[model samples]
Structures are given as C-alpha cells and as structure tokens.
Target: MEIQNKSAGRLIKLIISGFCIGLIATIGACKKDNIKKEYPQGSNEQINTWILDSLSRYYYWAAELPKKPGLGQSPVAFFSSVKNASDRFSQLYLPNQAGVSSSRSLYGFDYAVIQEPLSLEVLGLVKCVLKGSPAERYGLKRGSYIRKINGKIFSSSNVVALDQELLTGRTIKLTLTELKDGGYIDQPELNMIAGLTFEQPVLHQVIERGGLKIGYVYIDGFSAGMASTLVSVFSGFKSAGVSELVIDLRYNSGGEVSEAAGLCAMVAPGLTYNTDFIIYKGNKNGGQRKESIGEAATFDKRLDFNALLQNNLSLSRVFILATGATASAAEVVINNLKPFMKVTVIGEKTVGKDEASFLISDQRIPKQVDWEMYPIIYKLFNAQGQGGYAGGISPDLELSEFTLLPLVPFGNANDALLSKALDQISAQKVNAGLRSSINEARSVSQIGRILSDSHLAKATQSIVLTHR
Candidate 1:
C-alpha cells in the first residue's frame, strides 16, 4: 500500500473502483467560520444536511431519495433513511482519529463472529488472514475462534464497537479460542496493533487428480499491487503445467478495476495489448467509460503478447468458489469470463454489487470533520452488454461451506465446495447425500458472522472515486 499525502483535489481525481466499496476541487480551505451561524456547532441536522447534499448530487439513486429526511434524527440514521431502499453497498464512515487518510487501512484479518451451533452464543471465526499481518503473526489462522475482544464478550450489539476499536486504537487484546469436543477451548491471548501490510493477492497450491494437475488459488481481495502478484502466480502455474484452476473468492470484497482486468486478461480468451474487458455505465446524470484488459490493466509489469500467452492456462473452463463476500471486482472476473470460457461457480450466491461506488467528500469542509460518503455511481457490464446482477450472480453448483463444521483448510479435498469442483474435473459421481446436506443446512445455518455484521465486514473505507 502506497502512503499518499494527498490534497483534497488530487485525492478526488485518483478514484479506484472495486467490491468493498469516491470529487474534485481547487477552493479556499474551509474555516469553521464558513459554516452558517444559525446552526449550532455539531448539531445533528447540520451534519445530516451536508451528507444529504452530497448524496443528492452523486448517489446512483438520488432521484429516489426522500425530499426532506427527518432533521432531528441522528446523522447516521438520517443518512440511512435517505438512501435508496435497495442499495446496501453505499455507506458512511467516521474518519480515523488522526484524520481521513488513515481510513484506508484494514484490520489485517477478516473474521466472522458466528452463533456457536451448540451453545448458540456468538463466537468469532477467522475467515482470511493477510500474509505477514499482525493477526497472522499472532497465529490467527482461518477457523480459529475468537472468544473475546479486550476481555469483553463480542455480541451482535457491541461488534461494531469492536471494529471501531480495532480501526482507531493503537493496540488491541484478543482472546483466541477453538471448538474442540463440542466445547470452546481457550488458546493464547494476543495483544496486536494495526500496521500497513502488503497482502499477497494470490495463494496457490497444485493438486494431482487422475493424471491432471489442478491449480488452486485463493484471492483475498483485489488492491492496486495484485496484478504483478497474479502474473507471478500464473507463471508458476504455467511452469508446473497445471491443466485446471480453482479460484477461491469466498472472501474477495473487490478492489482496483484495473487489477480485475489484469486477472481476466490472463484467464479470458484474449491476451493482448488491447482486449476489451468490461463496460462502465452509469445513471442519466453520469456518462459511460469503456476499459480494456490491456496495458492499462497492469501498471508496473506489462507483459508483451507472447509473454502473456506463455503464462495463460489455455483452458476452456475454470472453477470459482464464491459466497456473498465475492463481489464487485471479483464479480467482474466471473461476468467477463463467461463470454469466452466456462466459469463454473460453486458455493453460495455472490453479493449483487454490479454497481460501482465513489468516495465523495465535501471539499468545502476541512479534514477535522470525520464524515465521508461512498455512494454508488455506476453499473458494470461485460463486453457483450450483459449485466443487471443487482440481486447477485447465482452459482452453477449450489453448495455452502456452512455444511462443513470446524471449517476445513483451503485445499482440503473433503471441504464441500472444493471437493465438488474436483469431482467435476475427475468425472467422479456427485455425492448426492453431501449436496442434499448442504442444501438443508442452507436454510438453518450460516458459515460466518451474524447477518447484521456481514455488511460491516464488507465495507472497505477506501475511496475509489473515478471522476471529479
């Protein structure tokens, strides 16, 4: 992650669009005196008005908003009331205590606090850990349980506070645990702090089944630096002569559109300097932008046509493991590849985030004010002019990881999702009983955190403003 000391105008111009979900100005710095005298300092209505003004201008569904939301309501509540009833991705975040720029940092680990099947108490389950992160250094691997945070039990109500604490505080204490013999066993306590960590976008391992080499890659999320990491991963896969690929995007919330294009260029039919990838279309208020899977996709490491071909798997079909967490830039991969190859999506349906968002802040306001808005600004489509996955793209093979208790490691053959993908490749008979079990569990159980907390887990505070 690059630490950019950005001016308000320059920050607005560098908008990057992705899954987790930004303005321009050269204006005089806004002093406190610039605000109206009639409104008392820090009044809820005044803050709410600022949010409403920005939403009315840039929100994708601005026309649908209520004319005058309740003035007395809390600023956060008022902001919610004005939002389009259907748009779940648009969000508001209070800036870090230091200032707005620190909002771009992540918690290092994406965990889910779920209901313990036996006790029915909320328990945190690790989803994905960034490589070399404090969480990883503290030995927080996927499937490990979190019993407490700062010695306080985490329930649905206080989870948001936990998130805020992790994001803003200098240090945090985590009581890690695990499920053993139908009971929670305490592990070592960890005192950790947030730090800038560069995540390895691609995690890969090859498996040999029936004389075919299957390459498995787990993409945590797509950020600016992932294109080169992907190239290296695919290059290794090519050298090893893998015949099939399984991409695990169950936790990918989305990032940089360019990086999405780069990954698609590698797997899609055309690997060249200028291959059309996807179309960016917005509402009546905004114009459209066309982007290609070309040189623009990979910033630092631009491979020539032949070098791209050498790294290509050349397979007609691939398997993707997705959940509601698979969204935005991740969905771009699924949607863009459909036209050229066979994309078999396994696991649950994705987060229907066909629309992209922008990070918009009132340039007139100074950084001391902690409010920022991310509103849906455009809809995405493949080259074929096909999109409208607002409800999310369904999987071809419907299975959920919730069916497997004590969630198995990434490449485990018995893991329901991966096993099904491998079964398809090996031509083995589908396990009807396992499929039925997963289907049954779908109605009653869930893999990760409570439904209320899922949205918070997916909201990336980084601004991806595409235009001024």
Candidate 2:
C-alpha cells in the first residue's frame, strides 16, 4: 500500500513540473513576439540611419555654408534661427525645385517660379536680363543640357553641392546637346554666368469682361515685405478704380502671419476681427494659463481684426480664391475676413492646420540633432466660433472635375474659379450701382423738398453724413 501511494505522488509531481515549464515557454514566446512587433525587424537601424543623415545634411547647409557669407555666427545660432527646419531641409534636398509635393522627388531644380524635376525633358526658358551686368548678356535657352557645372557632374546626390557652388556667382561652363537635323550633337564648353535672386511674390493681371474691369492678384506666399507689396497693389487698384478684386491664394502655402493679417486688414470692415481663438493649458491640479508658442516676439504680430478695421477702406467685397495649398496664415485671412465683408471663398478646402510649433535642438548629444514638435499649441475659431476645416475648405461653388484630357481643351475662362469670382463681382457692382442711383435720386428729392426749411436742412445734412 505504501509503495502504491509513493508512485501516485511521484506521478502528480511530474505532471505539475511539466505544466509549469509549458506555461513559462508560452509567456516567453509572447514576450518575444511583442518585442518583434514593437521595433519590427530592422526598422530601428533604418530610423537611426535616417536621423544621422538628416543631421549631417542640416549641419552642412545651416552650419558650414552660412559662415562663409559673414552672416552666420555659430552652429547653435543657425539651428536656433531656423523657423521651418523641414522646409529648409527640403530646400537642401531638392535645392532647385520651387515646391515640394508628396508625389514628386524631394529635391529638384526650380526656375524660382514652378517646381520641376531635373529630367531629360526640357521645358521653356525665361528671357530676363541678368541684373548688375547688362554688357554680359546671358540667354538661358530651353533644351540645353546642364551637363557639368564647375567641372562636377549633375546628379541627385550632389545637387546640393552644385547649388552651393552656383551660389558663388561664378561663371559655370556647360556642355550642351543641341538637336541638329534630327540628330543629337554635343556642344562643349558653353560658358554661362549664374546669378541668384530671391523669388518674387507678386502675380498681377487685369481681366476685362462683360464691360467690367476686374483685377487679379495671386499671392503664392506671404513672406517678408509681402505687406508692403500688397499695400502698393491695393493702392494701385484704388487708383485704377478697379470694379472688383480677386485675391488668388490657390497655391499659397502661407508664410509670415503678420503679412497675411495685414492683407486681410486692408479689406476687412470691422474695427476688430477674430483672427484666432485663444486656448489655455489646463493641468491636473486645475491650474490654467494662456498657451504660448513660437518666437515670443512674432506671436503678437499676428492678425488682430479690431486693429485692422480701424483703418477702414471703401472696398466692400473681397473674392478669396483658395485651394488645398492655402493653409496657416492664408486660413487666418479666410477666417477673419468671412464675417465682415462679402467674402466669396471659391476653391477646394484649405489645408486645415491651425496650431503652431516650435523647433528644438538637442546639442547635448554629439549629433546636434534638431527637430520640430507641433503640439496643438492653440485652437483657432472664426467669428462664428467654428474650427476644424482640415479635410479642406468646402468651396462655395465646387467644380466637378479639374483635369481635362490631352488634346481636349474643355475649359472656358469663366469655368475657372477665379473667373467665376470675377463674374460674381461684376454682377454685384451692377446691383450696387442701381442702389446708389436710387439713393441719390431719393436724396435729391428730399433735399429739394426741405430746402425751404432751414432748420430741417441742417438735420438732413447731419443725417446724410452720419449715414454715409
């Protein structure tokens, strides 16, 4: 009996030990799986490589080059002064491209007008005279292959280097391939001088239609000096007696917020406008304070509607042309102007991004890594107390399709959103004219009837001035 009991106990102990081992193995396997999923297989190494490469590029562009111009002070100052790190990096990556889009290459050559890739496909050229040297006439003709600038081959990898070399204003010798009698011929040693200038912001045109004069000003960006430029343009329109003005912000990715606000103030009616809704940060302890961000100096310079309306103008209506590219400061203009004026927003929805960010650098590490974190610093609301237009700004008049097939020119001048805005302004002008004529006639009749009454005449004049 004792031997049988011992055998049973031994069998139970063996079973329990086996179960414990299996459980531990299962747990270990799950932990391994979690670790694998968290970092993937080789993604951590790739991310580290990317970070290093980005830092290296930033150091080269922001640190090394600026020092030579007698402008840049220190590496720390360079990183701290950079407003938009990503944008600066993007410019370095595709030093030549005018703009960056998700579908296109990161960097490419831009004639400072349109963003385009460096390709065998040759487009048209500009015929502008080079500044400061009229005797040295230069023609940048289309279809000319930009073979090697300063004896270095042009490639995507070394495009930034090429850009840096060209920035020196040194004459570059190009080897071109000319199309001759349906055969390609190489032309060696074509000496061409390169001069760099800051990109311009003004796009102006006058469209006369339906016996009405309409003006179009497409502002692609609101950079420094934009406010002065806009003021000048609006003053011109005021002198020209333009019936209507179309402000096209279709591809405006936004810039200086102050400039945008200044532009809005020119047209906004009321003494004060709600540029953005202010938000306060709340803590678990129930403490709260107004959220502050960016360069403290620049924050106050942003648009204040009430201040803008203090200098009211005769401009009654404004046609705002927008698209997905209209964002940040552009959206601020749209939001602030909507309540006070006859704002006709005609385009696709805007890029809904209301919050701001600050750029931070960690110099404690050897890499001197710099990056930006865009926290929802503040929430913005229009006068009507609405926000979140991010999917895009819904067009007042939506078009069914944008692109037309090749060889099928299926669009009219009026079909464009800007053109449509012009039509609306023209119709409004006619209505306004009729109303003005009726008011004038009524005033004349009243004045004539009251001319004999001296006491009433003073009151009538007071009323006229006050109402007007």
Candidate 3:
C-alpha cells in the first residue's frame, strides 16, 4: 500500500483493526437528492453540533472527547478533535464514500494494477471478475493485461481519475494491448457497462510437486457469500486427496467475522462443537463477547457445513501466503487456528491490529447527521488469551512480493510467495537466499493509492463480537 503524508493534526492512519460486529443499523434512506428534510436546514456549525453529540454518546472513546469542543468548528474538524488521540482506526467518512464498502451498493469487477515485470510499465491486472459483472460479459479474464484506458496511457497521475470515472459512470472505454517483440501491440477496445455483481471470493486449484498433492485456495475476503464457497473448495481438496494446503491472503484484509469462524471450523480437524474459539474485550461501557467453535448451524447466515464434513483436510499443518495487507478477520483466522494446527506463515509482517471497530452512524435526532463513524470498539484475544499484537503478527519465514513483480497466476510454481510455501511443504533448502530488491526508489502507481483507500474502508468497518 502507498503511504500518505498528512498534517500533524489530520493523519490518514490506515490502521484497520477488527472483524464482524453484528451491529448494522440502517441509515436514513438515500434520496435522489442529498438533502435531508426531517431536520431544518441550519448553519454548518449547527450540523457540527449534532455530530459532536452523536460522537459523545456512542463513540467508543466517549470519555476521551473534550468537554467543550468549539461548536463553530466544521464537522470534520470537530470529529478530529473528539477522536481518541491514540486510536488510528477510528475515523469519520462521508455517507457516499461509506456506501462503497457495503456489498449492496458495490457493483463492479474488482481489479488492480501492478508494475510489469522487468519494466517500469504499469499494467492493469484483473484480480477477480465478478460472476455477472460487465467485465465478465465483455470477456475480461484473470491476468488480462490492460495497457490503456480511454485512449490514454495508464499512469500514476490519471489512474484515480479513470477509476472514479469507471466506478461511478455508466460506461467506460478500455484499450487492450500486449507486449510483442518488445513493443506494445493493440488489442480490441471494450466498452463495459457497470452492473451489480456478486464476487466469488474462494479461488481454488490443485498442484502436485515433489510427490505431494497440494490444494491451493486464494480467498479474497471472508464475505457471507464465501462461506459455502469455502466449503466446496475444501471438499474439492479432500476429493483430490491433497496432502497439503496453501492459502493466499496477500489481498485479503478482512470481511465478515462469522465467516472467519466458519473457515476455522472447516479446516481445524478435531474441534469440539461449541467450544470457545476467541474472546472479545471492549471498553468498560462495552462488555465482552465470546465466539465459540462450532458448525455453520451456529452462524448468522447458517452456512452449509455438509461439504466441510465430507472434505475436511484435517492436515496437521497448513501454509499461508500473506503481506502487510493481510489483517483483521484474516489475522483472526491465523491467530485462532494456531492452537489447533501448525500454521506456517511466509511473507511480510502483518498489519499488527488485534482490535475491532464498529460501523457507528447517527440517528440520535433522526436524519440529523449525514455521516458515519467507524470507531475502534474492542480488543480481540484468541483462546490462549493472546491479543494486543499492535506491532503486527510476524511471519515464520519473511519473503517479499517484489521479488516477483506483476505476480504470476495463483498456483504457479514460479510465484515467489507460493514457491517458498511449496519448498517448505516439500522440505527444500532452508534458505535459498531469494529476496526482493524493492527499496525507496520504487514509483508507486495511482491505482495503488485507490486500492489502499478502498482497503482501509473495508478494514475499519469490522464488527467485534462477544459471545457469552
């Protein structure tokens, strides 16, 4: 993720700390207009006053709010003042921007760009084309190389502008190209129309190397829809008689908390039904909650676990590929599973956030406030009472993604991250001494910033649960 520089007072601290907290309160309906008629239109200061009241009453750090924040301040400024100084994940966002984080309003084929291997050229790589997305209709496949958009060469300066246009607009033009004979050759341009799409988070495949059949699954996030998909993927692995597993979490920051538990229950071999999986401790005002290990019958969504039983790998150990972006519900998977199985982590250090946040919005005065607040509400601990990993969870073997620029396909044996995991599974040379040369000189693309912004939104709105 590309780091941003901000003023001492206003920091874009992208510290995501949480899992699913089932406190989703509905916001006032969005009208064709942005105006709210329930409350009389007042000066900007009056609006700020309403915001202050909401923060004081419901914010996790209500006690930390200053006694008399100047009401004359803008809502954003007042928000910054009332925020807990120590909390980096607590933040306020505009309602429109917040909508993007929700699965309901979100529609598009999610993709990201990367620097092409052995060159400074940036290429748009399709991360996942949603099942019914326009990208899919237009035949955009994974690993599709997008050389240009709207007749302009994709560069750091124009990527954000193009992204906003593509997401918000009805239609977008693209220019497809390929590198041939060390030169760019144009392919057919496409004009894709945006529509609703349900993303398939579980990507699976099987590999046999060095007399070991490995089941590889790349989970994008732990969305509610993915719970059953995970079961099916694991079932496939079981049917293939795979002896090992590799989970790729490089782009998965987090999603639903229940899904995390479901994944653990599916993979962990000998878990007793209804055992305490993890504990959540909130502030003095916010009581603690415990999540138990059990079948999908206990989940809010009631995910099917029939596949889980049929295809439980029950391996003694599993390999995970992660990066700094691996966090929240993703980290929860790693932390909670440690007691049950051997988890070999290979990649960079984790984001180190072991807390959770709630999606806090205001209806104190009924449509009086037009914003939402995501506040850090609780700290999470595993069954071993281990929490407060604010420095991030360290990897057992540290490797860099920069070693293999423009990442190869998920299960490709040559992919740096996957290769290292396979090596460990096959008991290859302990230290092959392959490291990335990436340093301060690297030029970050604008798409990188766009992705980080989206990721931060997803990471901050986690719901920390307490089970009894």
- For 1-468, candidate 1 gives per-residue lDDT tens digits of 134545654666554322112111212225443654455546887778777777777777878879757867887888888888777777687765344322124446776667754576677767667777777777877666787888888776787676566566667788987655556678777888777767564668898888899999888777876766788789988889998999988877787777777677777665566666677786667767776667446444544445555678878899999987787888888888887789999988887778777677657645423578778878788878888997889999988675665555688665678888999999986455744432222222544446333433463332222322
Candidate with the larger lDDT of 1 and 2: 1
Clash list (residue pairs), candidate 1? 15-465, 16-464, 19-254, 22-358, 22-359, 22-465
User: What is the per-residue lDDT of model 2 for residues 112-201, given as tens digits with 9 covering 90 to 100?
Assistant: 111123223221112121223311243333113344556665554555455455445445554544434534355566565443444554
Cα RMSDs, all models: 15.7, 19.8, 16.7
Candidate 3, lDDT over the whole model: 0.66
* Worst 10-residue lDDT window, candidate 2: 459-468
Best by TM-score: 3
Q: Whose TM-score is higher: candidate 1's or candidate 2's?
A: 1
User: Any runs in candidate 3 off by more than 4 Å, and if so which?
Assistant: 1-58, 72-77, 91-120, 156-168, 295-311, 359-372, 400-402, 405-407, 428-468
RMSD of 1: 15.7
TM-score of each: 0.71, 0.45, 0.72
Query: Which regions of candidate 2 are displaced past 4 Å?
Result: 1-197, 205-213, 272-316, 360-376, 400-415, 427-468
